[model samples]
Target: MDQHAQRHGARAARSHGTVEPEHGATTAARHPELAPGTSGMKGRARHIPATVSLPIITALAFGCFIIFRTHTAGIKGGPAMLYGLAGAVVSGALGLVVAHFQSTLITETRASAYGALFGCSLGWVYSLGGEAILKSCAFGFTMGAVMFVAALYVFRTHRTREPHGLHRPHKTHHRDDRSHRLPAATH
Candidate 1:
């Protein structure tokens, strides 16, 4: 067949959802692990290292912010360093705990977990500014509630398609509408 005809045929096949497989490669040749009757591995493998690294990254960012803020508040260099390191460790541990179990949770629970995490972290950092404990806690609680509400809204909106009842009914064309007809053929 000519190249143009072959290209047209291939395009038509793709539009119909079936593609001719490559001639020289057998299934076994492409993936040896799935040979004949063998069952490969079951279930999805957890990516342990990747999962663990997220919390470490979060901790580093949190610690850097704390260190910078403390130094700006006139803390001595050694004390500022200590505070940053300690904050990093604590945040990292909390992040690790959250990461481990987040996937198994329902949507609402997961949102609440993230909201609490953010609120508590921010509140701790706020306390470093010499705010009273009660003030810090209150600030954290307010921020957390806001986060929870926002997260809930996002999750609910994105997960589902709009209901049929919510959609405007499509307009139908009427054969009797003379305006839509072509002008009578001119002589």
Candidate 2:
């Protein structure tokens, strides 16, 4: 009947803390700081730290060994082994470089491109027989970029949320679900 009540329907006149939430609705207080607002851009760019770099390099090197070593049939202590070892060493080294320059905020595509650059470098050096310069460079570009962005994306998405006063109380919760959840006997 009153102006305040009419304006807010049934609960407009209620105090800020009194407005209860409806069913299944959570208060803003319960949610983590989300985006689209100021400071919503939580993403940041950074190089892979020392702790991560070594492991990444090691993984790539091991992969190179797996790939090249198994293929060379009986080339014991021969050019094949030498080349495989060399390729692994170079790949590992390039991985380190990729880790060092790995930027986070940069689009993952660009980051992968960066990684591909490093990877292709090794590919070109060892691909002496028939691989063309353009082909190797393209390969390196793709590999470097993919590697850089993938690493960054994984790291960025894995941040453990810190629960620091994140949620806001849902106004409708008190009025809707709670009222219904009451046992019929209690009602």
Candidate 3:
């Protein structure tokens, strides 16, 4: 439990070789000087948070702002803000439903395209005013497919390059084999 043991990543033993609690912390790594985040290339990208979800928050906040703005405009009945609220709520719902399959921006764009298609189908249904089976499926399908394809194409072609700043020379264990060999043969 002393600082030497902590810096050296040494483990105390119970009856078995199982590591003691003191050594189980991250400081016990072989290279104990390296912090968890900066240890290597693998460590950095593993911890990005859900900052991408802020758009949903913005949509809902804008919806609320619109409702207040409309209310102040002498609206006594159904306000124009309901459309904003509907857009915000529906888009958020769609995002939530689709996010399960989307692990990155590229995949999320495809999901958003799907949501757009769904929303258009809903709009087509609404245009019929509660009638049965008259959606503009062709238009929605074409648009959604086009968008998804375009997004994927861009992601594939314009992919970001690997960072060069962190590059390191390849590691090798080869040593002078001649020094370990027998003496030269004498005729």
Candidate 4:
């Protein structure tokens, strides 16, 4: 087909349900049973890859931390694995929850909440490893605060890139009413 015709055909196909080959399969095809535009207010949340990745990353990081910390503290193998696994599961679960429901909360609040959750999970894990309560709390709070600041920046940038909400003003067509009016009354 000629370039113009091919371009037109692609556009026409996109306007309908069928996706162009270069564009890849539709999201519904990949996810199955998830129709587009059906996710409601949190529709965009599913698109954010961090929802899945952050949890996995956090879990792995926790496992690593446990390994290093235990080794340095002279703790043995099985107990180190136990601590690591516990921290991984807890942090991962919290990360998943934050990533999934993040879109529903106010941007700043979501960041702070997620940070706090992350910090608390870490703090709890640290305490389980025999750290002092005061030290754990202080470390957790510091980590949480750092996360909060970082997340706030990231989320703000993300929000700006993708516009949302029902606050946009509608455009109305102004038509001249004089043409439809009756003749002015003459006494």
Candidate 5:
């Protein structure tokens, strides 16, 4: 019976892609890079330098603003160019600041900052679309509040999730039903 149980255990471990060696070290312990969360850490921490990130951010902002000015605002020529340039400059500056502060700030705080920026940008665009100052203010405030709450919730939820790729044993519950057994009938 013991040998049968041992064989079953070994088979289960083999099926699970894990083996308990005699030395009692897990495969992941021997190769930390193969371990759950640590695998991505080294690769993920490779930061984009500010020079490259800024230009990419600026280009994207410029393209978006040019599209907005031409399609939505019906602007053309020098004015559109200037607006696009302005957007590029603003986004570049914002990107630099974000990059600088990213390492220092908590995830929730960074999320809030991004949310507030989005709300402010939306409010500015709304005002440009002929809305009154008070209405724009109210809209921006509402959006900012919503964003703050959403960001907080998202960061909290994301932080609580376990990192994947770890092998964990599943637990099973066993119940004894001896008390509920019926008496054997005589043939």
Candidate 6:
């Protein structure tokens, strides 16, 4: 028999009764903890520095903006620096708290939390430029609403129905049924 026919026959034979494993079966068998749907890294915590990095960076940027705004408003060097440093520390703490709880929140609440954070930060910066408290709050509320709506839109548009990178096509068996056969021609 030709090599192709030999290979096809072998495949058919294997499919008929052989107990060959599907893809990733061996690896999954070796690690029961990583069984089909589970992530292998259960009970492991993420690195602390990596987790805090984004919040720190955001705090630093917020502080720098506050410092610049304070200075432009004719605040003296020491007070401007103090204001900036204080704002940085507060923002950093707030950011860390938000980051910690963000994962546990539902999508809408998480988005609103982020929006509130952003709005508060912006309003604080605005106030540092000598704006009145009422005006600053109104501005912050408006900005927060905008952020919340934008976040909802983005999340809705970009969300996937299934987990990323975890799709597996189902295996289907073919049968040699009479419905699949061609009809005989009449003489």
Q: Supply every candidate's count of residue pairs whose N, Cα or C atoms clash at under 3 angstroms.
A: 0, 30, 0, 0, 0, 0
Query: Which pairs, if any, clash in model 1?
Result: none
Ranking by lDDT: 6, 1, 4, 5, 2, 3
Off by over 4 Å in 5: 1-55, 58-71, 160-187
Q: Give one digit per residue, the lDDT tens place, for model 4 in 26-124.
A: 676566437665655355666658669778887889778977787667788888888788778777787788777866777677889878986887677
lDDT of 6 by residue, 1-187 (tens): 3487566553323454443344223554665555677665641323346448799988999888888999999997999999999999998998899777765666688679878988988888888788899999999898988888997676556556322322334655466666756798989
Candidate 5 overall Cα lDDT vs. reference? Answer: 0.62
What TM-score goes with each of the models? Answer: 0.55, 0.37, 0.34, 0.58, 0.47, 0.57
Candidate 2, 12-33: lDDT as tens digits: 3255545455523455444323
lDDT assessment of candidate 3: 0.53
Tens-digit lDDT track of model 5 for 34-111 = 667775766343455754666566557655765575546666577666666666666666756755675556766766
Per residue, candidate 3 scores C-alpha lDDT tens digits across 112-156 of 665574546344433333234445465555566666677556545
Task: Give per-residue lDDT, candidate 2, residue 159.
Answer: 41
Q: Which candidate do you rate higher for lDDT, 5 or 6?
A: 6
lDDT of 1: 0.75
* lDDT-best of 1 and 5: 1
Query: Which parts of model 4 have CA positions greater than 4 angstroms off?
Result: 1-49, 125-130, 161-187
Model 6 CA deviation exceeding 4 Å by range: 1-50, 160-187
- For each candidate, what is the lDDT? 0.75, 0.53, 0.53, 0.73, 0.62, 0.75
RMSD of each: 14.8, 21.3, 16.2, 12.7, 16.9, 16.9
Pick by TM-score: 1 or 3, better one: 1
lDDT of 4 at 120: 86
Higher-TM-score candidate of 3 and 5: 5
